[model samples]
Target chain A: MECSVARTLDVIGERWSLLIVRDAFYGVRRFDDFRADLGIARNVLADRLGSLVARGVLERRQYEARPPRYEYVLTPKGRELLPVLLTMMRWGDRWEADDDAAPVTLTHTTCEHETTPVVTCAHCAQELSWGELRTDPIRVRIPAR
Target chain B: MECSVARTLDVIGERWSLLIVRDAFYGVRRFDDFRADLGIARNVLADRLGSLVARGVLERRQYEARPPRYEYVLTPKGRELLPVLLTMMRWGDRWEADDDAAPVTLTHTTCEHETTPVVTCAHCAQELSWGELRTDPIRVRIPAR
Candidate 1:
């Protein structure tokens, strides 16, 4: 895929893949815990976890050696997806959920204040809405596939 | 179902659905233009467009009466997803693209500075890392279906 957004979607666009990542963010590690929280089929969960690990978005660590228990943990690359998930949650709270029924409120521990995330310019730190930003793309002509 | 991320994903999580949205953002409105850019099958594109219009993410407008031409435009609800797309694109440019080969560069029009997006705390304006945030979610016990 020539487009960066499409490439990103290829990795984690599915509902299940994202939900798995969400669970991992909330400290769900063991397979059983993921299953418990997600109510996901065992085979499907295994498949998604395996793919995430292969893509380096997650890692499998042997937490117990007696019976060889392995737990999934987000890798550095996986942690970079935080903003994507945060923005998605904010969109849902505003659009889908009933008024005053936001399922979660995020608190910034560094600031000791409750906050939502705002996407801002990396250089100037101005908050970016759709109209404020313009893309000057280096257009690579991807052959129509 | 109780999770907002999952709920938002329910609306636009599929790869094709998102790609269609991406095309819309890039000013692709007519069906033929979207099909040309994405090379998506006609049936699939039509189905996704219909669903988006039904969900109020997109609205259809008739531009020509003689030949009956219609175009799809993002609604305000849909435009609000700008942050999510920005974050996703940034992540992809960093992780998926070859180093220094970013497909697009975004400019903050007001600042006249080219920048990438940074996710920040809405309250304190500090840049957010995954570790800096804590969630106090109102956990609604959803029955595992």
Candidate 2:
């Protein structure tokens, strides 16, 4: 199988693809609703919806017959992507929010308190993110010159 | 600027880029260490290192004199990417980790308790992660559609 990160992005990173998924998370499942929320063209929304449904991230159910309304619901596989999307929202909140207030806030369902998420290393267990560490791989072992 | 999510990925999602950054977060700097940890190829690692340095995500500082060894350090700009990377790790832990013992775990610095981060929408005060919210652009007027 492809690397988890790459595979995940490959499925999610097609322009407007993530936004569509985001809408599903928000309970906007109708084609028109997705179109309206994203300001995306009908054709693009149609294509994304079809692809997402095909990918098993979404399940389509017919709710109306006259106009044939359908709703998109997240499967376990789709729900699994929540962390990735949350990461994006956090990033947007930190860097893109126009004010002191976060563009989004995360609350623990159990404790019901506003909280911040952190990343730590498995080895040293340091809080990691951008500036916490440094990395690069070099080739050609240098001989004592 | 570009859509916040897309722009964020552009910075974090170059091939093997996030992993390299992940290593950095682990305090693995220098060429050989990264090579050892990631098993990345020479050329690919080299390219990623160069690009990250150029993007101001990392800085090259000589650590030795005889052969002039160098180590990559995270800049403030790079430091800001922490939350995003943390989110990614959280996602990986949830969806990708195989055992109950996740590849990594998050701990709240202040509370000193293992915790999970969440993303909530700014406008609605609803958690955006876990497929709970969707974004609305106010209108469906396509820019490039």
Candidate 3:
């Protein structure tokens, strides 16, 4: 489908794109910062940065003159991606980590509790992690190539 | 960094991969179901399914004999991906959408309200959105290739 969601994912779905954006969320704005934070190759970093700038997710601003260095700042589009990144962080925190360092601890502002976000069904209003959801009966087939 | 949070993203940062997982959460378990719901190319879907199965997120079980039909079901590992998908849907529904046809809607069980599952600060518990977050002053940099 040519939906905006699909379109947006097309731009950001590549290997290191979201992680680069995550670095931006962490306040690593420069090209060098992203390269450092991600350990991504310079070419890959340059390409992803170029794509983000093209998509209006980021804008390149000169940070230095003689050295010809630039910093990337989040545009409204890029800033809009925080929720996605946060969600990834939340998931990574829960399922991927070992005992020593938890990925992140999301603190609740109103309840004063450090918590992870849960998805509740809009229909049932139940917080469903994994086991809570049942299969919907309607099924479709993937066409053979 | 060697953190799993970083590591997990390395595995699942693709756009279609996450979308496939999201469809699974909606109870779309079969290959055909994913193909129809996502409108993804057959080859890409095949590759993604194979990758997910190999990674232990999904399992392929033969359901029919003559035609050798198979169904893709989420394993516990795949089921654990629900929160991550929920967070993405929640974000898309909020800052990204232009109108009432939101990316997705969620339900909360405690109050039985079909409210948006917002990411609030773990400390104050106030609903946090992308526009609200600022960078932590501490700059954590990893290696760059």
True contacts kept of each: 0.76, 0.14, 0.27
Q: Candidates sorted by lDDT, descending order? A: 1, 3, 2
Model 3, A97: alpha-carbon shift in Å?
2.2
Which digits, one per residue and each the tens of the lDDT, describe model 1 over residues A91-122?
99888886656468888999999998999988
Give, for candidate 3 chain B, the lowest lDDT window spanning 10 residues: B134-143
- lDDT (C-alpha) at residue A57 in model 1: 93
lDDT tens string, model 2, B13-98?
A: 55577777756756777898888767889998999999888877899999899888999877776766766665554555555555
Please list all clashing residue pairs in model 1, or write none if there are none: none
Docking class of 2: incorrect
The B-chain TM-score of model 2 reads: 0.79
Least accurate stretch of 10 residues (summed lDDT) in model 1 chain A? Answer: A136-145
| lDDT tens digits, residue span A1-145, model 2 | 2233434555565667777776676667677777766789888788888887887778999989988878888888788677676666556655555564434445555445555544444443444433333322222223233
In candidate 3, what are the lDDT values of residues B1-145, reduced to their tens digit?
Answer: 5454465676576768877876665567787778878889999999999998887788999999999999888888777776666555444444446574534334344554555444445454455664444323334453343
TM-score against truth, every candidate: 0.92, 0.58, 0.72
Interface RMSD, prediction 3: 5.3
Displacement of the residue A73 alpha carbon in candidate 1, Å = 0.1
lDDT of each model, Cα atoms only? 0.86, 0.62, 0.65
